[model samples]
Target: MVDYSTQLIDGNGEFNVTGLDNFMKAVKLRELGLSYAVVAIMGPQSSGKSTLLNHLFHTRFREMDAFKGRSQTTKGIWIAKAVGVEPCTIVMDLEGTDGRERGEDDTTFEKQSALFALAVSDIVLINMWCHDIGREHAANKPLLKTVFQVLTLQVFVLTPLEHLEPVLREDIQKIWDTVSKPQAHKDTPLSEFFNARYNLYATIKQANWDASKVREKLRRDIEAHASSVRSAKLSEIVASFEKKLGQALAAPVESLLEASEKDTWSSIRRLLKRETDVGISEFSSALTGFELDQATFDKMVQNLRDYARSVVEKKCREEAGKVLIRMKDRFSTIFNHDTDSMPRVWTGAEDIRAITKDARSASLKLLSVMAATRLDEKPDKIENVLFSSLMDGTVALPSSQNRGIGDSADPLASSSWEEVPPENTLITPVQCKSLWRQFKAETEYTVTQAISAQEAHKRNNNWLPPPWAIMAMVVLGFNEFMLLLKNPLYLMALFVIYLLAKALWVQMDIAGEFHHGPLAGLLSLSSRFLPTVMNLLRKLAEEAQGNPAPEAPRPPQPLGSHNFKGQTQQPNTVSSSVPVSSVSSNISSTESGDEYSSPQLTHRRVSNVEQAESS
Candidate 1:
């Protein structure tokens, strides 16, 4: 009259297979098939095996009463449903070894029961008393040996009672050391055999009984719903996380930038570390709504961290770009502007070496601000980007020599006019310094061009006609007014002035006096006064007559204004007097309103008015 719900098999190797079916049915798990895990427990007689299973699984397996004596309580295998675990767990209780009534022949029953449990179970628990660890027939040893020899499909876990001496746990390690020998294969250990057996059992179980196909189905389910997993909602979550990270970083990054260049990156690294921890924790909590398993959730966390890092890095680069602009402006301010912040019109008097050296130092200091990234993970990359961007061209040079140096430094300057470096970051200090030297060279070359431009402008603004042309206009009587008489004296004076000017120009060219230096500038200035005085006299005579003064010539428009038809046309005339001062203004903000007009150009208007009064 055995209770089928409690006892799955009776003594004498009689397996109550129907008892197992009935118990599973009562628990509503028989039809569930492979949607559950099977656990079995075995140990020495009265080693609290039944009590342990009852407490652990919350099952009603009968335990032996100490007063009634130490007889076997579980006669065979007792199966029951686990109370608290997920997916319907079925726990199997095996008969204890060293039975008082049974003799040595009982080993046959123990081995058969263990084999049966191993065949059906995924995990088997081996329980033993602390005192029995080193005993000859330490019940667990023979049972474990039987399972190993038989190569049963189960993973065995040893359960050591806390009431036992701590030293007894050493016995478990000792036993494993003795039993974990190579099986039939040279390098194969006993654990490998057990693992292979367990995997085979699981495969068979899945094929015959498991309707859910748990592992395969989980994989396919994740795959089928991958788009949903990576949905626009998830993207929005990532973007939100990035926004939070950015907001967290903005204040600190700005504070770091306001400091000295050397301090900026170091401060940013510290700031990033502090903010990243808080950001990751918050982001992880938000991800829990997706209800993913540990593995999937951890993978998503890693991807989110990677994305956040990239976004932060991109922002850091943009900030670095702004810093680079500030740095270049600092260098240019020192090199191309005076203490008054006026644009430098490079006269030969300025010290080229001192200005360039200061600019170089400032540029280097600016570069040092971007020596590392916020993570300090990609210093080389950050430095390279900053350096490349600073020296990248904004304005093209005007001369052939300038173009030559630019071509050597940057091949793309002519096409895109942007000089970015190739893929790899600049690594060594030598490499960085070398690039800096090229940049310094370009700056110095630019300064030289500026000086040459100013010099050319000064020469053109005070330009005079050739000595022969002046003689023709003054002495040959090809003037705008009617000449009543030919004056031979005036002709002689003009001839003498022409010869002097021709000699002076030839001598100046031979000595390179017009090239530069204060003496050369003075000489060039003195030579142009004669033409200005002669033009004034001629204008005065014209206005004295009833004829109005000829309109002053206007500068030609720039090259792109109109198409050329290869014709010379007369200069346009107008009734209104368009003074050069009124046409263009060059007043500096720092200057007094009346102080900085374009006096050289304005002098033409004044000469016109004086001539009108004199006439």
Candidate 2:
């Protein structure tokens, strides 16, 4: 028996969102947030729409008084907060349609009120007497048809046992009997028509009403309502969960990274799985408060697991890089220092072989740490994929080629070694030194870039107070001692210092400093020499252009030799005095010198004889 203030719209049908706002405030809708759900009822005049809502939700919405003779007691639309629902529920009582008071001619208010309720409510109850279901002009039918056009409407039967539990579905024959009438082939009997429509409707309706499907949809709707009510809260919860997962993973990965290279691989696989399980377990526990259905819960669990897996994979690689850094540190330490950590003064007597062996061993061990990236699969497979990614830009040199001390090898020397060494075999100290140097350079560069980016971001965001502010406070503050007047020299010195500092800060290029380093001086020298180098190259190119490339010699040609350079004619040794008939007949033998005087005349005689044969 909770008291709820009922909100009403007057009979004129004039309402704005402000009315809804006032009603929401009265119901404490803002306080309920996403935990609130709306239930609306629509039915004919005097059909117990408000009465049903009052009983179901423990709301005291105004109902019609039979003694007073009903004349749309609930005019327009009415709303009240539910008193006894699990979630914060708002019950909407829409104006009844086809009222005797309003008459059938004007059902505009009824339609408008129904639309308004349907728009705002999570679930709508279409209240109708069992007898009125088949009637064409029933108030519920018109509203249902109207709602069907706009909403994804589903039918559910509420029983005395529970609120939303579905009743046993009627048999096809029983459904047909209720919706149909027997007629002697009256176009197609009304029963047949109803049965055809019923069959199609049953497919969609049954799917929605299935126990599992109903539960899933309800869970989704609940989540949707909760999201709308408290979107910020849910976002905060998810962010908190992600933060916890990251924190949980930090320790194991850090511990694995701190380990000696020889022990890193096996330990990483174990630690990665353990930390991933922790993250997923924590996320799952966090979701329990939402009270999701089994399907949704399982789906969320899988999604979290996948997220954990990706995070684990990335973290494993990063931590592995740390191990490589450690190995490089060891190699550098051994190569550059004596047993006492003192800088080495290289001498002829020093056992270079022993020192080099130790350095090589350390580098190899570091590489081994990188090889163990996968938790459940083979190490070699993970090694291949990881090395492929790390060495994506690297081009391997031929096995026969050995790089000099100062010369650069492949970015990852590991990429150049196609064959994995046998357990007993070892790579040379020179190779190890080259590889370690490259790896160290790459890791240091990445770290420097990351630090620079973070610094830039901080500068942009200005998380801390600027340095000038402190100076300004000291110089400009109201001091009882009158510090500024008493110390003119100090003020002038401060001004000079500020101007100098501003000039330097404005001109500073931190990123350029990192990228260029000691190379800046050398770069400036190169820039000065660049024009001289280009002019020298141009002069050399001009001098080299004096000798043109010779043409290729052509092959020897046969006589008549149109293929020769100048198309030379053979000597006309035969006499032209012979008859044209003889010259034409003997043209083939003329090359054997049967004396056709002119070669041109003999050719013309042959051409004339050939043209006559064609005609």
Candidate 3:
């Protein structure tokens, strides 16, 4: 049902997709759980849904075989087990919806088949053209909507109560927004509720305001009122803020609030994302065509994401529970809204860093504390983990040395130091996978952090190339050649050579493959042109020691068998040249009492994690 394949190659009589090795594998999936994943072959009478299924599933339930009958063959859900041993597959060919009107009560199984298929399958592979994504009420649209409605309901039932809270709120808010809340019904007498609504407006209306103005106002106010604000209580600040908001709204005065900020789509997205986080994942039919207003959506999404994250972390190992308790205590103090922690200079950098750092720490601390509590241990150990994780993109001093990171060449420069728990035994492949995901996320996060600061770092992430990146690559590569020759004028000449090489190669392979596809794809990649380009970059990088290391390419990895689009594959050999100091000599990837490094940390960490359960 869920097609893991990317393409369906067309041929003389039918698609030549059967030539693919995966076609064999797919046939086996047809019967994996003994519950045949119902795949509905749907399209206009001639968009080739049936033809596609017949070829894909190897079903002979009467298609336009050219050698068979001329009339329409299937009437209801005609299913046949996949021919090959790919997997247990059920191919359900539904009557085409776009066919000419047969009779007044003539029932096509499009709607019914969709409902039935969704209930039973592990996946539902909707066969359609790439062009059908946005079409309104296209032949497959109703089927998709019905299936979605059904799935959404199932999701709500299976999920927990806290998970459903945000979804419920989103529905209510969406309805109120679309219907305008009847002008707040002349304001509630509850101060907490009123202020909450007021803050929501502040968040919405000021969403697009320039930071500079706000910074200036904050600075002036802070300097003028620092002495007077020393003894201000938490409740007092909230009250003051509410009073200011009420005056601003009643007077319609133009302050720092940005007029151009409020947008409807963001509101909808906020609500949608929040609902998804809370696991509601579907809207009540009563609010189907409703439009959202103001800041309703953003707040909802933010709240739900935060809550879902909280719930999931609480479900981690017992040790994580204790960590959450400590974090809650810390956050309660921070919630006092005291301005002392705020920076003196309102540089956007400080504000962004402080906010993000606090948020990240709070989240990790919560998870760690929860784990600790659940495991029945002191929450203090979580502090070490929290601090270590915060150093994700930065260097850490030796616990014994007590020196700050980047104390010399780059006191501020981030260090590439990561190590698994010392002497922790890796036990299972499943544990290995989990740790690997954490490592991969950390690596990608480092890259993101570098980019955020206009810094450079090495990471294996490679996906869609931005046009600017292509131009920058050419410029940087050509410059290396120009520098060697000491001639700036030769820059354009070198760039031309690069472009010409690329153009000639594109015409040679990609052009031929446009309609024929996959045929020329491998050639283009394996061609000398690509190799030549790669060689040129390697030379350039070698020439400049300052150049950032390219992400380790994963083209030929053995571990990555799934080959999903945009997924980075696992490589056969991993070679990293991290500083030896970065390796925790005290922390071994094994509990064998034999501390030594292998070619690299491969089977050792996994083995250690597995041992922890026994230890």
Candidate 4:
């Protein structure tokens, strides 16, 4: 058989991880889990602590020989499995304390081994010589002091019945009285301070190494130990499964939400059920070792499923909290770009009304998906209700219209849906209505800007005047045209003026400035027109006066080397001023109802507009 013992901690206080792993595997300790018990023995150097463990639990801890004289035997802490002990008790043989070899000043390892034993062991056996019991400076006194300083534990004193005189009992009581107690246990009695006293030597000698009584005692001790630990183990198991469920559901649910497909909730339900089923299967398998009854097992499994469902619900609610942001993003994605994901030019040929309806419909669908939990697969008319009520404006009749006979009541007038449970409702009917209003109000400006852009595109492309205006101009200017043709100098002057006007028009982006409206365009033109003309006049006058005019800056090279005739080129210009009225109107409309507006919403809208303009 494989040796099931190893030095757990070496003399230098380092844990032997590899040796411990091998020891655990040899002992099959993992199969015991939390059902096992730990029993540790500690005392003065060469005082037979290892011998006592070997006798009581049939362990193979090395013992000191009397012929070799008194010295340290066990170094650090050595652990071994009890061969015949019931419920799988593991025994620890701690290094002997107060040896002349280590010197008087060094008790660090002694105190450390004592504390480690008390911390991990369910039963600690302190071995001391019978003669040293009543001494003022007993070898185990300092060890007891260290144990007492950390935590209050039930101490057990084991001895042979023949040596257990009344005086020895008094010495044990006196030792307990001398050890300093924390304030919380200062008034406790000796009987309460220590576990029961036992004649361990007699018990071992009477049983003749059969260990039948020791096995029974160990079984009881392990049962008591398991009782205290079972609840915590159960909690740990549930907590681990809860964390796994959350991790499994997080990514898939987030992707489903972003896609916002028709069957998104159904997909999430399936995912949750699958993950929870896997968790419950593993959980039940783990609990099988515990041998729990049917009711308790069923309760734990149900709790796991409930926790998994709660995880999905929590994810839905968290995504619902960001519903407005998601809706805005969806609207932007559909409305700002075309089929190929290229930025739209808002050409007049595209139908703005149809595009706006399609974008709003998409956004509303997202809101509908998030409004409730549909894990039961029961289909509800949430999307249709929202479309008819909010998008189509067919749910809420006007007050006057409602006053008419046989007028139907508002469908979206309630706070909750008809079939949805309160626990499952992420967003209520009223909240959806309010959100739709805000979404429409916020998105209206994009549509308006698109319409304005289409108008501007049409206006900019029209190079020819109407036919009637052309006729009138030709008829009215016939005499002037003839006169100009008769004089070569006049015709040349007219050509120069035409060239100057065309150059100014191209350089200033005059057509772009006039696209806003008549009054605003006139104001914009008046602001820049006079200064441009005066600068041109000044430059010409200086050149005529024979003063060296500043060298004209060279134009940038065109992308193509060949220059084609009959095509008019327009200079690129970035407009610094955006029309303020459109911006103000958009902001004011968003703020018309304070109930729907927040500082964050306003700031976000402003930032989005700035980003759009920049792009």
Clashes of 3: 48
lDDT of 4: 0.73
Q: What's the lDDT for all of these models?
A: 0.57, 0.53, 0.38, 0.73
Q: Write the per-residue lDDT of candidate 4 for residues 429-542, one digit (tens) a residue.
A: 889989988988898998899999998887777768989999999999999999988999998898999977975575445666666666876876677666556645655675
Tell me the deviation in Å of residue 309 in model 4: 0.9
What's model 1's lDDT at 301?
73
lDDT of 2 by residue, 1-615 (tens): 655645567778766467778777766778664566777777778777676666555577776676777667687777777664556777778877778888877767777787777677766666554445445566255555555444333333322232112222232233333432337643443243221111111111212233344334544655564565455555676677666666766666666655545456567667657766776677677765565679977876676666665566667556554554666666677666887989765443455556655665655555555444434544243233234334333444445666677655543334332343332113322344455567657545533443455555455444357789877886778692377679998788889888655433332322333344447735543443444334334434544774323222222211221211112234443335555543222112221122122223433223333446758
Q: Cα RMSDs of all predictions?
A: 23.6, 30.7, 42.7, 17.3
The list of candidate 1 runs beyond 4 A from truth reads 1-6, 30-35, 147-167, 183-615
Better of 1 and 3 by lDDT: 1
Q: Name the candidate that leads on TM-score.
A: 4
Query: Where is model 4 more than 4 Å wrong at Cα?
Result: 1-122, 127-138, 141-222, 285-289, 395-408, 465-615
TM-score to native of every candidate shown: 0.32, 0.36, 0.21, 0.55
**Candidate 3 local lDDT, 1-615, one digit each (tens):** 444332232211133354444654655553343323334444444445565554545456555544453345445444455544232445556555544444324433456655665665433444433344345444245444455444421111111123334443343233333332235643423222211110000111212433344334433433333323323432353344334333323222111111102232233234334434334233222122222233744554344445443332233322222333344444433432235864233222344445445545554443332222111111233335334544364433445666557454322222221232321211122332233245336444533453454321111122348789999888888867658578756766878888767654542343333333455556545654554456346534744664334323322311211111121223332334654344322122222222223223212123344458757
Compute the lDDT of residue 275 as modeled in candidate 3.
39
The residue ranges of model 2 lying beyond 4 angstroms of the native Cα positions read: 16-22, 68-70, 153-306, 310-370, 374-615
Worst 10 residues of 3 by lDDT: 195-204
48-82 per-residue lDDT for model 1 (tens digits): 77776555555778888877878878888888776
RMSD of 1: 23.6
lDDT of 1 at 233: 67
